[model samples]
Structures are given as C-alpha cells and as structure tokens.
Target: MAGREATNPGDSAILVAERLTRVLPGEVPVTLVQDASVRIGRGEFVIIRGPSGSGKSSLLYLLGLLDRPTSGRLLLEGEDTGTFDEDRLATTRLAKLGFVFQFHFLLAEFTALDNVQMPMRRLGRLDEAAQRDRAAQLLRDLGLAGHEHKRPSQLSGGQRQRVAIARALANDPVLILADEPTGALDTKSSANVHDILHDLTRERGCSVVAVTHDMAFAQGADRLIELVDGRIVS
Candidate 1:
C-alpha cells in the first residue's frame, strides 16, 4: 500500500480513505481490499462499480466504519479515526453515518414508522414524540406517507426499500453509505431508489457512496470509482 497523499488544503472532503486495505486470515490470507484511497465531498454522489468479488462492498464497510481496516487510516470530516476506541467508533457511526443495504433488514415485526425510529431512539437526541414525528416525516418524504404503520411484510418491495431508506435517514447523518441498495428491486423500483438518493444529494446536501452493479445508477453519480480485483482501476 502507498502512503497517504496530500489533499488540497481547501478541499471540503467529508470522508477520506488512505491506502485502505482489508485482509482476512486463513491457511492462506485473502485480501478483500487493497490500497484503496478515495475522498467524498459534501453533497457528492459517488458510485463504486465493479465485477462481483471486486471488493466493492468490502470497501464500503471500511468507509462506513462497520469494519476496521487491517492497515490504513480512515478519516471522517478530516478527523483521523485511528485513535477511536470501539465505543467511540460506534458513537461516531450513529451520529455521523447512515447505511442502506440490498436487503431492507427492517424488523419483520416492526412497523415502518417504528423501524425508522430505531436509530433516533438509539441516539437519544429526541423525545419519544419527537422521534415518532421525525420518523413519520422521513417516511412521508420517501413517498411512504400512508404506509408508516405497515410492517415490512405488508409493503411492496419498493415501498419496503423506501422504508429502509427512511430508516437510514433517521439520524440525519452527514453521509449515506449504501451497499447495492437497488439490487433486489425491479427496474422501476431501482429507478425510484436512484432518484431518491440523487435528490438527497441535491436537496439535503448529504454525501452518498453507493456500491452498485447497475450502470444506470452509476451513471447518475457525480463520480464513478471503478474497481478490479480488489484495486481501483479507474
């Protein structure tokens, strides 16, 4: 892995990765990501596209702080995360980052509103009523205005995905990291998800980093980072 390069002094980067590498050990070690470096500015939508097993999702996990790098540094809002303890890292993730996965992952028993409120409740920045109100507003914003009370099982595939997106926004994070967010949806649903995410960058100034195989989704991003065999090829 190469050393970190100096970024422009005036650059307004929200997230940065310097020579990020992740390795899993076994009889023979395997590297999932290798010397990956990227920067995401506020309101920028970046799409990571690559063939399967190219480490797109692995890199996303490292950037999202869901997984630690084996040998590299990740900086969030210009702050180095190398010194953060596990608890601090968890707190940072809750306060600064949001995530949407291919699977909705909503609690099967919880209503859309309740699922969206989970993050707010965990953060404890709002009272019960306030959380509910905010959650309702997010669902409405995502075009699920009347489906708040519906469980994941009760909603259509697209609606359920929208509910998941609403849940991702529950904490009002500065950056949204999505892993194949539209992979499970039909064409129409995928387009809807793409539009919603793009609108978020324009209207809310939220940075987005999405790993996707969909060319249409990648085309809509401000920048596309292409990877090959665990390395960025473009």
Candidate 2:
C-alpha cells in the first residue's frame, strides 16, 4: 500500500461498485436496483439520472453505506464493504463517506457553525477550537460566513442548503454522495448548488456522485448514468 499504483492509497479509485443489486420486501418483493456497476475515480463528478421512483435514491444510499445492498459488492478506497460488520462499516463511512439529501437535514436548534461541526463532534476527532475553526472555514468557503451563527430556520433556502453542504464537507470525506440536492431549490438556488459542487470537484479534488432528475445538472457531470426501473439503461 505504498508506491505501487495498484496498492497505493491515493491511486485507488475512491468508490467502486460491481453488479450491485438491491431488493426490498413489499407485499411482493421488489428489486429496486439490478446488476448496477460503477467506478468513481478520485475527483470525478458522476451523476445518476432518472425519473421519480426510478431507484436513484436507493443507489445513492447503497453507495453511501446508509443501506446495505441485498447483493453485489461495493468498495471504498479499494476496501470491500460487504464483509465489514455494522460497527466497522459505520466507522468506515464516518471516515470516508459524506452525504447530502434532498432535504437540508440541518439541526433546527443548532447554529450553522454547530451543525457543520456535528460530524467532527460525533467522531471525537477535534478539539473545540479546531472544530470551530474547521467548521467556520467550510461555512465561509460555501459562502455562508455571515449566517454561521444563525439557526437553520433563520437562513434563506439557498443559505440553508449551503450550510448543509458545508456540514457534509466538514469531515473531509473522499467521496460525497448527494441525493436530489437541488430538488427543493428555485432555479437560481439550484444553479448555485450546482456551482458549489462543480467548484468542489475542481478546487478540492473531492469525488462527487450525485443523483438528480435535472438534465441540465446531469449534463455538467463527467459521466451520466441513466437508470430506468432499477437498471442502467444507457
């Protein structure tokens, strides 16, 4: 795991999913995703596009470790996830995976800065001063400097979304998984979120895999994966 490209940590793709299939139990068991395979290189911008109920969010959840796949294998930084126990999987996710959902899941009672710092706090990796500094820097970078002290309800829609983005980045994850991140925003706000994600990949070299129905946003990605009824049709 030193210098060889195959073994080197930096040379490994941040995410790889091979033949991933997920099935959920309904009155009739429904397979939500089938034989989906993807490899996301570090710093690459990848998009998953589909219509409503097309299994886009399910794919994101599997990749983000929010839900385990019913079949297939997923690797994070070349480490196989299928064998990990729940505790270990959670630890790996906290260390390497970041997630943003359609809703801005910020804590209503915490200030923006505190909300951004929550992950670090949960991980117990930073001192108070360092946590504040890191959270503040991420908030500022996401253009939420003045709103740092405000609670989620106190900020505008766009500002709240930016704060959510900042919170996702606070842990310095190698891969970011977003599910309909711009779904609730107006055109301008949606564009701003897109710009922020674009800049993140370019400037910070963070790999982003996003699920969206917006064709315009999908067009900006390095790769577009179109899912139809749980399979990649294109």
Candidate 3:
C-alpha cells in the first residue's frame, strides 16, 4: 500500500464520491450512508472499517455503482454517475470496474476457465479465442493453472476464491470493489488474497477499495476509513 510513491488521494483520482448518501424511504426513513466523501487514486489500496451495521457495505455499494445514492454524486475516472440510467450504469460497471464478494458466486455448470471468461464475453472486447486465452492466463496467475477445466465443485475453498479473483480481473478492470473477499477463507488463504489485492496496486497499478472487519487487513491499506452510525468518524 505504501510503495507507489505517495500522491494526494484526490490527485489523479480514479473514483470520487462527494457528500454521497443513500437513504431507504418509508414512513420512517433510514439512512445508510451520510455525506460520505471518498477519493481513490490509481494504485491505491483502501480499506473500509467499521463494526457490523456501520454502513461499510452500503458505502461500498454506492461507490461501486451497484446502488444509487439518494443525494450528492459519484464520479468514476472523472465522469459523473449521478445522471446515468440503469443501462448506462450497468454498462459502465461492466467496462470499468470489477467486483469480489464473500461468496465466489461461480456458476455450478461452468469450468474455472469458462467462469472467468464470462465477463469478457459480456463486454465483447475480446474474441472467443482471446477470451479463453486471457481467462486461462488469469487463472494461471492466481495459481489455478491445472484447475481451469474443473468446475467450482471440484476445487477447494481457497482455489475457488482464487478463481473468483481471476474472474474479477478478467477484463483488466481499473478498479476492484471487494466486499468481505476473505471472510470465508482460512487464515492462510486470507493472507494470500490480501497479498493479491495489495499486489494489484503495487504491481498492476490498479486501485482497490475493500470492505472488511479485519484490522490486520486495514494495516496494509494506504487509507483506512472508518464509519459509525452511517457517518465517517475521527
């Protein structure tokens, strides 16, 4: 998190959220994120920390364009997302961002290579051969070289998670938003996943914003942001 030669987070920002808020409406409205402003620079690894119900996942969802903010605005790579329609938002997410979650979410019927190729196929940037080649390479990079033909059921938990990581990187996304990516892994796998996310910043110059309860994970981040009761706290 520290080796990229520091720059102001707002300088050359890849994603920026200004006073972003998401509120669920009803007779009694509940606010999940309140006036949250965050800036992530290229090659930066940022960690979001808070206890349960502290709005960490809510804030991440907004930043990752999975949920719309009720107020304020969000920008990714300098373009405002506040006005994008659902289709446009989905397209942007497909092209510019990658995601990982606590669950691998692999298709039960697909092989590891096929699962990783799905995103590239959706984006349509690569031809079928290229997609297969890139997916295979990604799996190899993640140490799943021999398992490319195997389905999720055939792999171990760590191996499946690594395959998930490969799928996230399938399109060479500039930013990755991960929600509890290591939550289900053993300690060794957790460390391995952490190092991979960290290396993406140091080695690939890709930014990462992750939600996690692990303080050890936070210790390696360039920025550790904490929220309490839906608001950022000192």
Best by TM-score: 1
**Clash pairs for candidate 3:** none
Where model 1 places Cα greater than 4 Å from the true spot, the runs are 1-11
Task: State the lDDT at 116 in candidate 3.
Answer: 98
> Candidate 1 on 30-90: residue-level lDDT in tens?
9999988888888888898899999999999999999999988899998999889999999
What TM-score do all the candidates reach, one by one? 0.96, 0.93, 0.95
**What is the lDDT ranking, best to worst?**
1, 3, 2
> Which candidate do you rate higher for TM-score, 1 or 3?
1
Superposed model 2: Cα runs more than 4 Å off: 1-12
The residue pairs that clash in candidate 1, if any, are none
- Candidate 2 at 31: error in angstroms? 0.5
Candidate whose lDDT is highest: 1
Error of 3 at 8 (Å): 4.0
lDDT of each: 0.90, 0.85, 0.88
**Cα lDDT tens digits for candidate 2, 99-200:** 888889999999999999999898878898999999999998988878889999999888888998898888898988999999888889899999999888
Q: Between 1 and 3, whose lDDT is larger?
A: 1
Instruction: Tell me how many clashing residue pairs each candidate has.
Output: 0, 0, 0
